[model samples]
Target: MLSIALLGLLVVSAAASPSAIKDRTGRVVHKRTTEIVQLYAYGTNISGLPIYAGSDNLAYLATDDAASNFTAVTWTIDTTGTDAWTVSANTTAATNSSTLSSGSTFYVVTDSSSDDSFAQAGFVSDASDAPSGATTTGIVTYGPYVMILEDTDDKDTYVSEFWATQSDTDGVWTLMWNEAGTAQDNSVPVTLKTTAPVV
Candidate 1:
């Protein structure tokens, strides 16, 4: 019985070993197969900007036509330096401006008047005293010397442009713009916490 058991073990071990074949000339033969894979790419039209420290203000400007398609907006920060930030969408058409946090800023632009199609821009300053009102033209000053000037019209492609002073505390902070093209006619300002190299 012990000899029979040992023989069964040997048979099991041989079956588990890698299989091999020999050619007619006593040479080894091997078979191999290759597989091809295809990757898919999707469209991302919305993105947020980088966050910088300086003043404590929030301001924005919109054109007359912006009132038709623009909707609720928000901001985010990128801690991974990957130029990615979180976004919070506002579904209501009643509000257009938002007060940002000390380390973050963000904005959203939409296609439908329902305030659904939103796009995000980069941050400028952390000024809290920035102006807040619905106006076609004006200069609003927030804390620490940051200003927002908005000029928009039916003929222009860019509906807004934002600028902020570099932070005095840490010169490391910088502004970043969205790489996505203007699929929809809108640009909203926002602040994102990002570690992405300054661009």
Candidate 2:
């Protein structure tokens, strides 16, 4: 159940503790980790805020979680000849990453990764898309690019994804859930990953 949860998020990131990743025989692997994708949401009130899978099972920005030591999901967008993408986090358990579509609709949810204990893989793969790959690592800082979002329930209708500073009971501001329905702001982004943000 937990492993499936880890592979649920459409995207992902991590806050590694310099722990050497070893194989079955305990030999330290030297491969690069998953290339982290930063999801910067653009809303009427919020723009460029990092979106993360919240403890409440919704998407929240860094402004929402001021002290949880939050780290968003890491991902790699496949740009094969055709304009198609897949949401299969088939990367080795060492990386635990997968392939997601270029412009598909996905949902973010809380998982159990030490990175944040949350993951959301709600995007659906199309038949025409090609296989995705995982080969990049480190902080990706050049793109505030628009990775258009779609609704998890209805991929036909597009939605503007964003996060709010509005707090719930514990004062953590997150936008997510379990059940599905119609809402205004359905699609949001989890952006711009940097383990050590400028201080």
Candidate 3:
């Protein structure tokens, strides 16, 4: 009897491939290659005052939603810095560095030339009050989430994309961009989040 039961278990396992599954109506249901994750992006506006004179910098311009689903995420920045702008300490929640996991990556693009009238300096201000623009794209993880930063006075912008994991509480978060420049009136910071839909 024991031998017969073992043989039956093996037979069940061998016949359990994707093609073997059936719905209640006995119709075959194809399996998906990847699991679908959901995320959303929403917010008001992100702009603020400058810390320096003649400065009109933007601070903490980010997506409104805190969750999203994606396959690849990327961030680009157009600044006046001739050298590569540092993305070390600049991030959302003022914590964690701008880094991604193995199946993920990050980037920045700066003008590196001369500062224009509307061009803000550095990555971008982190203040909650300013006018700024930033973009990002990436794969959605289990707890998908992202943040972006931009300068208020600078006409340039930043873009980023990467994969994010899903989670009940927001997972490891990072800032996609940061800028520095002139000051302006105070305002509220805009948060954005995105999620993939189920197919």
Top model number, TM-score = 2
The prediction achieving the highest lDDT against the true structure is 2
TM-score, every prediction: 0.20, 0.32, 0.18
Question: What is the C-alpha lDDT profile of model 3 across 1-199, one tens digit per residue?
Answer: 9999999998898679775787896655444323222223322222211111011121122222432221122232122222221122212322222223222112222232333222222233332222233222221222234333334463333332211112243321222222233332331222234343232
Give lDDT per model, in order.
Answer: 0.29, 0.35, 0.28
Angstrom error at residue 109, model 3: 3.2
Over 4 Å off, model 1: 1-49, 52-130, 133-153, 172-199
Q: Can you write out model 2's per-residue Cα lDDT over 133-181, one digit (the tens) per residue? A: 1111111222344322332553423222222434443433454321232
Which of candidates 1 and 2 reaches a greater lDDT?
A: 2
For every candidate structure, what is the RMSD over all alpha carbons to the true structure, in angstroms? 22.5, 19.5, 19.5
**Model 3 CA lDDT for position 52:** 12
Clashes of 3: 76
Worst 10 residues of 1 by lDDT: 34-43
